[model samples]
Target: MGLFNRIKEPIFLKESSNAEIQIEKLKALKPLLNPEGQNIIEQDIKHLEYGIVGEKNIAFELKNSHMTMYILHDVYLEDGDISAQIDYLVFTKKICFVIECKNLYGDIEINSAGDFIRTTDFRGRKKKEGIYSPLTQNQRHLELMKKLKVDNKNNILTKFVVGKYFEDNYKSVVVLANPKTILNAKFAKKEVKEKVIRADQLVKYIKNMYEQSKEIGVSDERLLEWAQSFLELQKEMLKDYTDKYEQYKIYKDKAVKSIQKIIPTVEDKKATTIIVKLPVEETEIFKELKAYRLNKSREENIKPYFIYNDKQLKDLISKMPRNNDELQAVAGFGELKINKYGNDILKIMSKY
Candidate 1:
């Protein structure tokens, strides 16, 4: 009948092309979303699955103090984070769990390296990237729970990687069937626990943890402040990367421009024009550019601009042979860079 009903009885729900199309549309909109936007949309999907599939009862626990919640969440100790903030916390009598909500799509694969990959269909092409390592992040949450001194040992403390429900999309929550699946995948486990549960059973523990934490103590403003700081730190770390990227771009442009003037070019400008991508994140491209520039006989006629990643390369690929603005986008190709190596890049490109 409906999507929710279909989950309860997958056979009867009737998979339609319309549902699949709707899910694809949602995926398209994911990138435009902010963190909060992304999180909410994901939660909506999970609830839809629960409604349709008759999921296990998930008890989440968080205190709404002054319209804010301070949640003791599952975390990874290796990443060294305190706890994650959660919205829904249900406390039931039997089981306990700290729910960590993730809005994701595709089958997740955990390998021997202790790394995780999320499978996504990018333009109908399957692509995977290393994402939130549940083992690492959740363990940190466990440690934080212990630090909080909650009587949770008597209760079950489990972590879940909830997959967001996309209408007609095959988004399934996959947890390693057992702890052995992870450890024998050859990664060391910080703690030895019995079997790891997935699907409905994980929800049961979440409900239990929520209920148990409620009896311990309600989270206070101090806890909220601490969570805020942690989130901020994550943002700050991201900002640092962005700033470095920007700096590299600015300097790279200047280097290219300076090279254009100094490097002697052939009369056939069109044939001489070529674009070479610079390496990013400690790759060989940086060294190659430097070495080539050093040995050039007519180094004055060459200009070189730096490029970091494929995305950066894609942007400049269209504007080959260096424009002022495009050159600016290259990191480390600053005015001094232009004065020194701009002609060198031009000379190299001219050879092509």
Candidate 2:
């Protein structure tokens, strides 16, 4: 039965993604936002689109692999307060694979200590930065799956055996979905190298793992049943994709109101005049800020506006946020941006 199943082509049990919906929602909200807010929303949409394309690349490979497997895309699982949004789950006759898809934009290097560093080159300059480990992320997803499986067993013996079986049969893989990313894993541990691979290498990697497994293969029916058991654990996420943009709109509105109070508009019968003035020293700070933005944008190989547009840059200079908490109070500096560039921004402001 197992041999017969192994000859069949792979099938996807779940493939639809909510990212498309989120993108559409963002597009609808973009026009309603101010110029600065619109820029930030556009960046969010592009990031989500890249993620969708990466997942689709992986999907295309799985559909064409001709191996016997059941695949699930975008499986959201929750166990009490702990939740995981897994990119893919593949069930073969002998093993279940938990995959984490990364559609990164730069060359990646894995050190002997298991740190993942990303390097991006723009023109002649190259910048290196540490990125979160997809391998570690996938391991957490696998751990959740293992705990759920073990807890489902009726007896202590069955629970222990299930836990042990899971450790042996379940595998975690980090697939780099971007075709152009160069992965340097030679310095990494053997275990780390084994867990990460390019999108094109995924099918071959799965086949190798399947062939090496000592567990007996099951029939297509049993394989589907096993896959279904895990599928049943998937929880429908009720996330409001527009929440952040809505908050941005509120912040923009408040900012506009605050500015209106500071610089009142005067109306006359034939003419209306509004006077605006800024400190002379702000000119130097603006130059420093723009230069910093340009350098950072080049290093990341992204548009300068993606970091912060002229309006947001002026806002930053006006607020002169001293720390992460103060930076968050500014309209465009979210947690991600704060964590990535906050300290550098503060240091520059400190000099002034």
Best by lDDT: 2
User: What lDDT does model 1 reach?
Assistant: 0.35
Model 1 spans with C-alpha error above 4 angstroms: 1-137, 140-195, 199-204, 210-215, 219-223, 236-352
Give one digit per residue, the lDDT tens place, for model 2 in 1-352: 6544444888777888767766886898788877888889999999999999999999999999988889888887665456688999999999988999999999999999999999999998999999989888888998899898888889999998998778788899999999999999999999999999999999999999999999999977888888888777775442334445544573343221122113434553444445333342346677788899999999999888777766567667656778887786553566667888899899988876
RMSD per model, one decimal: 18.1, 15.2
The TM-score, computed over Cα atoms with residue i paired to residue i, of candidate 2 is: 0.69
Best model number under TM-score: 2
Write one digit per residue (lDDT tens) for candidate 1, span 1-352: 2332322211111111122333344455445455665565566445444332221222111221112233222221212223332212222222223443433355555565556666667788988687866555545544454444332123434212111111111111223322222122334232322122343355444434344442333234333343443332221110011221233232243223222223336674444534454434233433444456445524555332222223333232322444444454343333444555566555544442
Error of 1 at 135 (Å): 3.8
Error of 2 at 90 (Å): 0.5
**Candidate 2 global CA lDDT score:** 0.80
RMSD (CA, Å), candidate 2 to true, equals 15.2
